[model samples]
Target: MAKAYANPDVLVSTEWVAEHHQDPSVRIVESDEDVLLYQQGHVPGAVMIDWHTDLQDQVVRDYIDKERFARLCSSKGIANDTTVVFYGDKNNWWACYAFWVFKLYGHAECRIMNGGRKRWEADGREWSREPEPQYPATSYVAAEPDPSLRAFQAEVLKHQNKGKPLVDVRSPGEYTGELLHMPDYPQEGALRGGHIPGAISIPWSRSVNDDGTFKSARDLEKIYVREAGLKRRSPIVAYCRIGERSSHTWFVLHYLLGFPKVKNYDGSWTEWGNTVGVPIEKGPGGTASAEASS
Candidate 1:
């Protein structure tokens, strides 16, 4: 297949992952929603990074601070220059979310393993129970968090006021307020249903294929550009019930489609839906249909 995005290096295929995974310069990180999935079976030499425990602050609703981030990387044998390749289950939902958090700490050498665990297992790739040997911990210092790639509720409100693009990457049921969570899952349900007023529903699943590999750039153009009416220059923010699923879309638009400015509103519906007096829209007629933006 032809190269899709302007900067296509953000993604690495399974074949490429298999070849380079054991390289000293490469570190394979598996971040999954199901915390125990990695222990069941995983890519050889891959280290599991639990999305909840490893990535988030223990007592707060925020991510781990930079100091903790540096420590986590050190424990994982990741240095400032390590090329970290992320892959996992649920179509890389938590994997991409982990990647987004990595970007927050200014890790530049990160890439997502294309097709994630679904494709990896389907291909009958090598799996292992043996742990990859960890390199000696290096003194790693995380860079200052990049505010540009993340969105706060204030910025999301501003985007709404300005009529800018806000992509709701949740399922249709959640988007329409008919379901509080993804179809069958009740554990992740939010207090309120419905989407942010003026936000467009473009489920993150549309970004990938049945085999869990992403579609060609041409097809992506049709989905995000033609169907959702997104533009390259426009400021776009994606969100889900939580931030995880939206991070997948953020990767697609920013790294895959090469949009210049894209942010993931990490607070997402969990924050918005519960906040008092936050405007929300429900039902088919609630959201304004997207049209191609200039």
Candidate 2:
């Protein structure tokens, strides 16, 4: 397939990772929805970074601050210059989320392993249950969080008012207010169904192929630019049930297609749907109401 992405360096194939798994300057991190999967088996030399525990603050809904982020990097043997490659289960959903957080702290050398854990395992690669040796911790200083890449609920509301591009990367059922949560998943504290008003329903899975690797750049161009009518400079915001899934789309548009101004609304539907009197939209055709209760 033709490579059409503007910045293809942000992604690396499983083969590239296999060769560099032992490289000293490269750190392989696995972040997964099922945290215990790393203990069972993971790519050799890859350390585990739990999204819920390591990437996010325990008390607050926000991500970890620079201090905690520094601690995490040192513990993981990551330096400011380490090329961090992330891969995980669920077609790299949590992997992209972790990548987004790393970018938040301005880690400049982050990359995602294309196809994630599934593709690696499917290709008959070796996995190790033994623990990797930790390197001497470095004083990893993180840059201030880049607010430009992230969106708060207030910004989302404002974006809605402005009629800017808003991508709802959840499933069709969730986008239509038919499924209150992901199929068979818990309610996850959302008080209402439906999506933010004026959001375009573009499920994140559409960005990847059946093997979990992202589609060719031409295909992606067709989906976002041609089909969705997005421009290169369009100010776009992506969201999902809790923001994990939307991060995938954020990475694709911002990194792959080189969309200039795409931000992930991390609060997403869980925050939007619960806010009193906030507008919500239902159905594929985008009919909306003042409240999700309708």
Top lDDT model: 2
lDDT of each: 0.87, 0.88
Provide TM-scores for the models.
Answer: 0.95, 0.95
lDDT of 1 by residue, 101-178 (tens): 999999989999989999998888988877555777978899888999999999899888777889999989899899
How high is the lDDT of residue 5 in model 1?
78
Q: What is the lDDT of candidate 1?
A: 0.87
* Weakest 10 consecutive residues of candidate 2 by summed lDDT: 285-294
* Model 1 CA deviation exceeding 4 Å by range: 1-3, 285-294
Q: Write the per-residue lDDT of candidate 2 for residues 136-167, one digit (tens) a residue.
A: 79889999999999999888888888777788
lDDT of 2 at 284: 81
Give stretches of model 2 more than 4 Å off: 1-3, 286-294
